[model samples]
Target: MVKYLDTPGGFVTKAAASLTLDAGCEFGGGVDCGSQYFLGFMAYHRAWFLQDRLALTVGGGAITNPGRYLVLLPPINGTTAASGTPYFTANPGDRYRAWDFQVAADVIPRPFITFRVEFNHRAANVPYFSGPGGVTPPGGNQGAPGSLVDGWSPDLVKTENRLTGALMVKL
Candidate 1:
């Protein structure tokens, strides 16, 4: 699953984190990949109707947040000791998610251009990754140490929700 932790338009990162939850100088030095901040997302679109002179377009999507249960938040939230190395938790994990939708209305004002206005509710597939790891056997709960690393998408982000209004010139 992926999680956000940045700006509003971007993924929700530790920056968007509630300052009150901060553990302070001793508690992981301001870290909060805290065990309660997981998320996910999905999106799709289509046209509803159109006039005799032009066609119309429409679409929407969702953010899937299973819930957050990370023992770590972000490196930026950490102090000097916090490096690429992640901190450990004493329990299992959880996930988080939220959703947003969108709609669009546009028309061919002339043969060469199509002017449109769009209204949309934007949300993202919160960019986070989680995969159980360790040398233990598949069914061994009491095996050696394991890990769940959280980081950005090595490739493209999962998805997003945003309102975009523009002119299409078919020249």
Candidate 2:
């Protein structure tokens, strides 16, 4: 969640990310769970031989849930079927791990402004991120409270690539 720039001769620059995952646990008739993981990288900015004042940063991060739990049910539910039953899922577990890498460039045109482009790759063993179809319910508002909507499965893929651009202004 934070970025660090090292001294010209400080040997390395540091970049880090924060990851969190929660696996529900059963207690009496209730369940509870949560997890957190992170990855970081160190780099030297003196390797940009093609461009002047262009900074390149490379980093990798991980996602993991090293908890003991099962399908997480609502802490409190007033449904007619049961009070602590969890929703249905074909594949449900309390453990998972994922990894990602990013390569970003900062084109510093001035002291107060910079144009940035980043390329990232992520790979996971479980369902993560939105696919061609997003996570939102289709067609919006299927019905009112307690009404069942048409069942639909999301397109959960294993690998994803993302390209992003940003215009940063620092005062």
Per-residue C-alpha lDDT of model 1 across residues 26-58, encoded as one tens digit per residue: 124333444333333333333322332244434
**Distance from true position, residue 40, model 2, in Å?**
8.9
Residue range 1-171, candidate 2, lDDT tens digits: 433433444333333344444333333323333242222323222223223346676766654543312223222112122332222221224455667888888877776887989999987665654577654456653344223445754445668899999999997
Q: How many Å off is the CA of 168 in candidate 2?
A: 0.4
Q: How much lDDT does each candidate structure score?
A: 0.36, 0.49
User: Candidate 2 overall Cα lDDT vs. reference?
Assistant: 0.49
- Cα displacement (angstroms), candidate 1, residue 21, comes to 35
Give the number of the best model, judged by lDDT: 2
